[model samples]
Target: MRSVEEHQAVVDGLLPAMPAETVPLAEAHGRVLARDVVAQVPLPGFDNSAMDGYAGRWAELAAADGSPVRLPVAEDIPAGRTDVVPLAPGTVHRIMTGAPLPPGADVVVPVELTDAGTEVVEIRARPPIGSHLRAAGEDIAAGTMALSAGAPLAAAQLGLAAAVGVTELSVRSRPRVLILSTGSELVAPGRPLARGQIYESNSVLLAAAVEEAGGIPRRLHFVPDDVDQFLATVRAELAGADLLVTSGGVSAGAYEVVKDAFATLGTVEFGKVAMQPGGPQGAGTVDGVPVVTLPGNPVSAFVSFEVFVRPALRRALGHASPHRLRAPARLTSSLRSPAGRRQFLRGRYDAGEVSQVGGPGSHLVAHLARANCLVVVPEDVTELPAGAAVDVVLIEGALQ
Candidate 1:
């Protein structure tokens, strides 16, 4: 059996970095920057007022020590106003927030300091020189790097790009993943189930997981356990798919269609890993296209994706930190695991303590739904006492 790290490396090698593509700023969110975003124009672009106040010469305003300095309001300037004139001596310009400052104006006294008048305003106090003035290029200079390459574009990054006059961004493209689930006894959900048939759910689970990992997922209808039909269906749907992920039919069973079909072609390899809940795995190229076969159980497929496929997809999308966020938390109860096999148990983590959500059963889909993290039990340890420190991989809404 292979170690978990070995299988991870195998899956990682299957996908190459995606090429960069120019996308509109509206669609660039959550994508990694393929190139540095250089500012085409300086932030703010020109000198503007940071407050709604009167713009005047500080020397004239400061001459009144605690006395009311009265000045005639020459003009009204609101935000987005252009064609501003220079401030004439002995007068002030009533300027609104974000309005461009008139030339020769060095200070702004807030409207609250005066009587809030429009034509003839009263300046009650003297503001310091350059007060309430947002200087040009104060946030970012023109032609400078606003955001570096390999950065994930989030709300703040997108806002900064727009502020610097960027309408489009070059970002790593999302990988297109095709999901296939095969089982002869499987039936679709919401349909009547006959005897000896179970509702198929692996496709839905895998598709959602793929999308959460930043890959576009296309789920194919579940195929029967026949090897020929599976092969034909896969070949027909492999066009334009960056990665083909199939659930089930790869285990050591009598009618494992994936293993049986691929064995004849001698392209895909199947094996077991030294991990509980997701031991049966396969990763290889099918007709020069990448393939990853996962277990059919719902919990097993989800765990396998979180362990192996999610990180690989994120790395291919140019994310520097591709792995799920992990932290060490103290266990609230004792746990047991089989020797020589790594165990990932469903857990609920909160405030430095993690509690097991369910037993170590791969078929417990309800328990997996309630879990926010995976408590990892390493190999060579069969038992753990209460209050033990174990590593937990944060998932599902566990990120703080």
Candidate 2:
């Protein structure tokens, strides 16, 4: 059997970086930057007050004795006021937060330090020169790089771009992924189930996982265990797809539609990896589009995507950190893994302590749903005792 890393390397080799596209600033959040975001204009475009206070020269307020110095408020400046004149030499300006500092003003004394006066303010404290003033380009200078390439655009990043006068951004395009789940005995949810039939859920699970990984998922209807029909369905849906992910029909079963359909293509490789929940794996191309086949069980399929597909999607999307955050946590209970397979058990982690949520079974979807992390055990180690420090991949919550 191939090791987990070996299978991952194969998947990585199949995916190339996606091309970049221009998107409006409103749609750029959660996307990856394709190029460096250089500032066209400096942040704070003009010098502004950082607080609601009085703007004046420092020399007029400085006194050897700690006494109140009252100055006539020469002007009242609120945010968005455009007609700003230079400060009178002996007077101060009552300024609101984010209002432009008039020319010739060197410092601002906060309102709390003086009586709340609109006409004439008494400045009780001596503020240092240039205090409470936000200088132009202090945060970012014009023509300087504001955000580097390969960084994920979050609220703060988008705000920074807007601050630098960027209306649109070039970002890596989200990959279009076609998701297919195959099983003759599987029926869609909300439909009547006959004897020997189960609800089809892999497509829904995989689609959500694809979206979370920054891929646009298109879920095709579940195909039965007929090779001819599966091939027809896949061929019809291959257009415009960057990646194809099929759940089920790759295992060594009597009716393995995916294996039987693609085995003769010579491009796909179907094999097993040394992992407990997601052992059966397949990677290849179908009509020039990359394909990955995962096991049929819901938990197994989810785990496979988490272990392999998510990283490849993130890397193609130009994310700098393509892997899930992993941390070490002490186990609260003992567990034994399979002798030769690495185990990824559903776990509940809190305050640095992690406990297995359920048995190491591939069909425990409910337990998987409640889990916040996956406790990873190496292939070489079969048994672990309580208090053992194990590496865990955070799946949800604040840490993730």
Candidate 3:
């Protein structure tokens, strides 16, 4: 048995970080940027109208009220057209939204205050110093750092790239993951279960975990308890996936296929910690691909995924901070755990205080589902009185 920190240290050194690649900005969503994104071109590119109004010098508008003004709609500047003609002296251009401002124009007046009283078809709103205008380099000047490396691309980022004339960007590539669910009594969902059979939910769950960590799951191979079958399947799958994730078969049971196979190849080391549910753990390289073997219990499997595997996968995909968030909060009730092991207690958080939500047992699956947090109880503390300060990892924070 190893301490939680010990095993975590072991898992940390298992895999190296992955590299980056260039991807289209449209496809950059959900991917981490490898390099800083500098704005090659200014946002809006040039001075343009932010609204449909008239363009004139601000000094000219301040000069007089109802000053007779006549200016041609120079070149009828629409969006995406660069051919801008200068504004004729003492004339206003009938500009539309997003149209480039004509040269020698400093202000825009909306078509509202014409007071011409239907005397003319195009009424000009007068006496506005600065109205309906977007200045050049107002949003972003050229050569500015728009986004930094390691930032995840969002919708706004994509729009920024498009605005800066960047159709594609370089980003970290998604890690390749292979899922292995080992059990003889396991059957995929949508099938009839035999007397001792259970549905194969680990692969699906593990695949989702990998996806959340920015990994591309290559394949999910189901292996039975037999050693020969397990070894064959894992060896075959490892050829493609950069990381191999296996659920179950790592526990200390007489018929544990993962332990049995690892005994011969020495590719995995089975051990336990003081944590609830996710006690049994194993890790090593199988056919040159990093392998993480989790306990069979569903809650244990998921906990192990969050605690160890998710961070590794995230680092492999180039994320800055890959682990779950741990925050300080007062415990609502007392909790107990083993003498020399760190415990992750299933919990719920409300009003900024976290409380243990489930019985202190490892196999309690329903309790985990009802829980939104994992209250961290460190080793060496026997009992925690109600209202004691403890660290908690929120599965979902309260809606702000």
Q: What's the TM-score of every candidate structure?
A: 0.91, 0.95, 0.81
Model 1, 270-342: lDDT tens digits are 9999999999999998888899999988888999999999999999988878998998999999999999999
| CA lDDT of every candidate | 0.91, 0.92, 0.76
On TM-score, the candidate that comes out on top is: 2
Worst 10 residues of 3 by lDDT: 114-123
Model 2, span 1-400: residue lDDT tens: 9999999999988899999999999999989999999999988789999999999999989861289887889999999999999999989999999999999999988999999788888788887888999999888889999999899999999999988889999999999999999889989899999999999999999999998889999999976567787788798899999999999989998888999999868789999999989999999998899999999999999999999999999999999999999989999999998889989999988899999997888999988988999999999998999999999999963224
Ranking by TM-score: 2, 1, 3
- Residue range 1-400, candidate 3, lDDT tens digits: 6877787777877878778899877788999888888999987677888776666676655434555444444445556667778887756666668889998888776656443222222344454555778888989999999988777787887788788888888898787888878888888889899899888777877787788778997546566567887788678667667788888887767888888887788877778866766888999887677888898877788888888888777776666777778888998777777777777878888778987876867667778778888888888877888889988887742223
User: By summed lDDT, which 10 consecutive residues of candidate 1 come out lowest?
Assistant: 391-400
Candidate 3 ranges with C-alpha deviation above 4 Å? 60-81, 85-92, 103-132, 218-221, 326-339, 348-356, 380-390, 396-400
Residue 52, candidate 3: Cα error in Å is: 3.6
Clashing pairs in 1: none
Candidate 1 Cα RMSD after full superposition onto the native fold (Å): 2.5
